[model samples]
Target: MTDRDAGTAEASARPGPGTDPDPLLRIEGLRKSYGDEEVLRGVDMALDRQDVEVIIGPSGSGKSTLLRCVNRLTEFRGGDVFLDGESVLAMDENDLRRRVGMVFQDINLFAHLTARENVTLGLRRVLGMDREAADDRAMAHLKRVGLAPQSESYPAELSGGQKQRVGIARALAMDPDLLLFDEPTSALDPELVGEVLGVMSDLADGGMTMLVVTHEMGFARRAATTLTFLDEGRIVERGPPDRLFEAPERDRTAEFLRRLTDLSEDRDR
Candidate 1:
């Protein structure tokens, strides 16, 4: 990070809203692997209805995997996922999916459909909202994210920020109690990153309960109610972002902080 980014980070370190609500999502012994590479090893966390929790770590740290398991997009080898106190591991597939909304990092918008149609797909197909109502709801959410004018435009026609905004609107359209974001802006150019992060900042301002796996430390310090640092499939440290990042307890956590925040370093490498 740059000196200017550090100032921005400090400004964002002010405390956010109140404590998160009771476990909107809870995971226990959540393990997932591909071949012999274990992505999540007995990962555990409690996400509440009013949380703006940010998960950060280096690549392959299971940050994204944890979010996927919460949504059941990636099945776990063991453990249970509870949503609003209901165990997703035991629920029917459709029921589990409806309760959790996800916004992928890639901004997977439909090429053929306009932003309005892409945002309205799940509501129309799953919730049975008619076209007119779907359009109306879609428009409202689009306006909320500053993408109302782009609703009629195709994804290819919009800038990266606009597309990501539509992705946010599409997820919000479900009116989900818990929203999971997987590196939502990792693919964006640096200049475009702020727009997406700005929308997220506004969402945090609006008190949306969300769990985000992101590399945006400035954002975590500024917008998150709590910050979690993970490595090797486990949360190494978690707490208020300022304390955790500024004064981490674990050695690995300190190293992570120095690397991610680009803090001053010791003389030796």
Candidate 2:
């Protein structure tokens, strides 16, 4: 096995805190594979309501895959995911998705639609709201993300950060039980990253239950109630961001954080 793989395997075997009897989101022994290569291996975690969990790991460490699997964007080979005690695997795909919204790494707004229209689409089609009501709901969410002025603009007319804010508004308009952010600011220019992270910080402060896959340590430190480190598809360490950042319990976690710090420093130079 690779060094990372060996370290993760050993770390994963360590006992963790006892599981809550009633977690808002529960993941048990989650596993996923692509052909012969496994991407997730016996993962387990639980989040209570209003928990903002930030997942950090190197590229190819299964951070994004785990988020996609939670929303059922990708099918898993084993284990179960639960939302509010309902089995996600057993729930209807449409129903499951309504409770779990995802904001992707890339801004996936509809090119032909205006920002307001993009936010209203799910409300109108999924929630079966009339145009007038959907428009009002869309406007409120857009305003929440500080995009009220860009409501009439199309995706191409908006900046990268603006498009991502619209994406966040669209997801929030759904009133989802939990939101998954998959490296939401990774595609933005460094200057634009702060705007999107600002919106996310507000959401966390507002008690939104979120699972975010990101390398943005600033946001994690500021907003994450819990920060998790995944490596070789296993959670090597997880705890409060203050604790994890100040003093990670494992060698692998410390090494990974150091690497990320070096990369961030290099980018700023």
Considering every candidate listed, which one attains the maximal TM-score? Answer: 2
lDDT of each: 0.80, 0.89
What 10-residue stretch in candidate 1 is worst by lDDT?
1-10
Residue lDDT tens for model 1, 1-269? 23223322432343342223456777766788999998877666676667888988888989988988887888889888888788887787666666677888899998899999998998899788999999999999999999888889999999988898899999889887778889998878777888899999898888788999887888898988778777877666677788887787667878887786553122112
* 180-260: candidate 2 lDDT, tens digit per residue: 999999999999999999999999999999999999888998999888899888888877788888998788889988888
Model 1's alpha-carbon lDDT is: 0.80
Model 2 TM-score, all chains together? 0.93
As for model 1, its CA RMSD to the true structure in angstroms is 7.4
Instruction: State how far residue 95 of model 1 sits from its true place (Å).
Output: 2.7
Off by over 4 Å in 2: 1-19
